[model samples]
Target: MAVWSLWSLLLWEALLPPEVTHAQVQGQVGGHALLVANRPSSFQVREAIWRSLWPAEELLATFFRGSLETLYHSRFLGRAQLHSNLSLELRPLEPGDSGNFSVLLVDTAGRAWTQTLQLKVYDAVPRPVVQVFIAVSGDAQAPKTCQVFLSCWAPNISDITYSWRREGTVDLGIEPSGLFTDGPALRVSLGPEDKSVAYSCIVSNPVSWDLATVTPWESCHREAGPGRASYKDVLLVVLPVLLLLILAGVSAWHLGPCSGKKKKDVCADEVAPEAENPLV
Candidate 1:
């Protein structure tokens, strides 16, 4: 009877306070789906256990080393005699890190408690690369054609399937290179006006997926037009030349030989003298 009573007392004493049991550490990347819990308290915690769904090969010791210190900070606090909650950190997290984990807590009296965690690792997709070149028409106002080449890169991934999506449109078919190449380039034709449209690339491995968006631009279409003069532009230029010609004509008319008095009367004087002699 005494043994039963003592065991009951032990169980009650081992039961944590509601607040302590409710204590947790939560970290998420991307969204709530990628959350992890069970950060240690900043008080005297006797033990901490880390379990990860990530592949043991992918997880390095360096990742867990700092987190261990972070979890044990409560034990080192000189002023406040408070125990801190434990935390889990993995170094060099990979797509495989997506899954579940648990941390077991052992008390000074050797009793143990465990917490369950659901961890989701999101694979980071490499940004899609696109190169665009434009061909213009003779008419400056006319639309131009844009030639685009797209490629995707994720060196960390060995085998992957790729897909291209236009933001406002549907999916385009994927071409397989069968192996990695420097120019995994895809050619797409567009108009200069459509250069503002965004293109997206979706990269997927067996474990994860990543996406990247690139705004299309044209090299030839970047400028409004080449820095040159047109017929209308030349007409604006000729107006000044025409104004100068008119000004010169008016100045000559105002101050010229035509405006001076005429030289006359010499020949008429000789004839008048002959007529006067006959009369005498």
Candidate 2:
């Protein structure tokens, strides 16, 4: 048994690619991941056991005499299968499925071979939010144009990339001055002609991508002149003040001292004649 194990180890070393052992395999959520054994086509497998090593070492699936055994764990039931190539397939993978996978294969000659693989599963990124900033030129006489800065963002994600598309095209060779591309943002000065063009921001990771679109007119508004106010906005503010002034004038007119008639003075008759008659 020892000699056969040593021989199987040597065979694996010769057949396995170097990258398969060194790099971690990435899988998308709700997708499938394959753990390859890289066994030679000529080799006949007698038995195999696929196991997980992280969170806890647990048996995932098993094969005996070229047939799958009845001892699959509940977590992998209906979702795991062993292929003829000695590869294990896990379907509908989830974020919690990320871990180390190990496979032990025994050949027809009772030779034991084992391999371990690292798997990482990630959730699909959400649709990105695009924010726009407009910087107006100080000079009024200059063309009625402004610098537009666009930023794309996705929350709670890492290892993401950002790309910008203008009018469904990727080329920006003819961009105007002040145009710049940063990590997740694009800054450009837009003239009148560019206002009608559509822009899109794409955010992606290894597993998934999301996109957001906007037009220059939607993000940027024409600069308002000094003291400029829309008629609706002016009416909204002025109507309330005018109503209050009219109410004040009406109240004052009703409550003021001059609103009521003045009272008349009364004169009493002299009582001296009455007093003299009583003395007599």
Candidate 3:
């Protein structure tokens, strides 16, 4: 589960924090790091011993240049190596491996030196999420003048930071407060000229960062809720129902005249039988 790779300059720029000395090295869990003591080669015929100093003090390795043989400690067995260049390499770093370490070096002339290094291991940062909720000045009535709240977060991580920023230029309307941020949340006040603008939320730690982008104008400027229909949609539905009602009224009026004609004809056909009897 361990393999060594070349440490590129760009990788160090991204991982190393500010004000850290060359002796300080940061790595991700399940990754590799090479710790160098930066000892000058002029100090010849040397012996070196490396030890873990913080959290727990323990011996890592001991090397003698004359014998060209090294002894390893159980803590770093099968996972650490002492190189000829007087550097220590650790692969597949563990979470419990963070702390301070030092190396004691003795030259042929009996002069001794000690170098200390700080090691830190971190978990990779996960992708962040952005969510938004909008509130109008008069409930659902004053949509043009409303507040938009956006929240950004990453899950289950520690020692992280949140930052909010807008991508491009924006023109604010009504309230004209524009945008303001507090920690992971941002508040925006929409006005008349409030066009669509992109916003980014960044979540980061010392070693990694992730960002999410959203445009609040898309949701805030929408005139209709998901459950409500637009004006054009309502007209499209009502026009068909009105046409059916007008057709029904015309058919009922035509049937009324036919019924009256039929009644008059029946009376004429009945004749005056009583009058005929009197004439006889």
Q: What is the lDDT of candidate 3?
A: 0.70
Tens-place lDDT digits, model 1, residues 133-199: 4433355543555555666665655456777766665335553442222334555666656767776
> CA lDDT of each candidate?
0.47, 0.70, 0.70
- List the RMSD of every prediction in angstroms: 15.3, 8.5, 11.4
Candidate 2 lDDT at 194 equals: 72
lDDT of 3 by residue, 131-249 (tens): 98876456565545657898898998878888887766545533234443548888877655665677888888787888898987767656444566756779999999999999999
Select the stronger candidate by TM-score from 1 and 2.
2
What TM-score fits each model? 0.30, 0.65, 0.63
Model 2 lDDT per residue over 152-204, tens place: 89888877888877764435567643332446888767766676777778888
The TM-score of candidate 3 is 0.63
RMSD of 3: 11.4
Q: Which stretches of candidate 3 lie over 4 Å from their true place?
A: 1-22, 40-42, 66-71, 139-143, 169-182, 191-195, 222-280
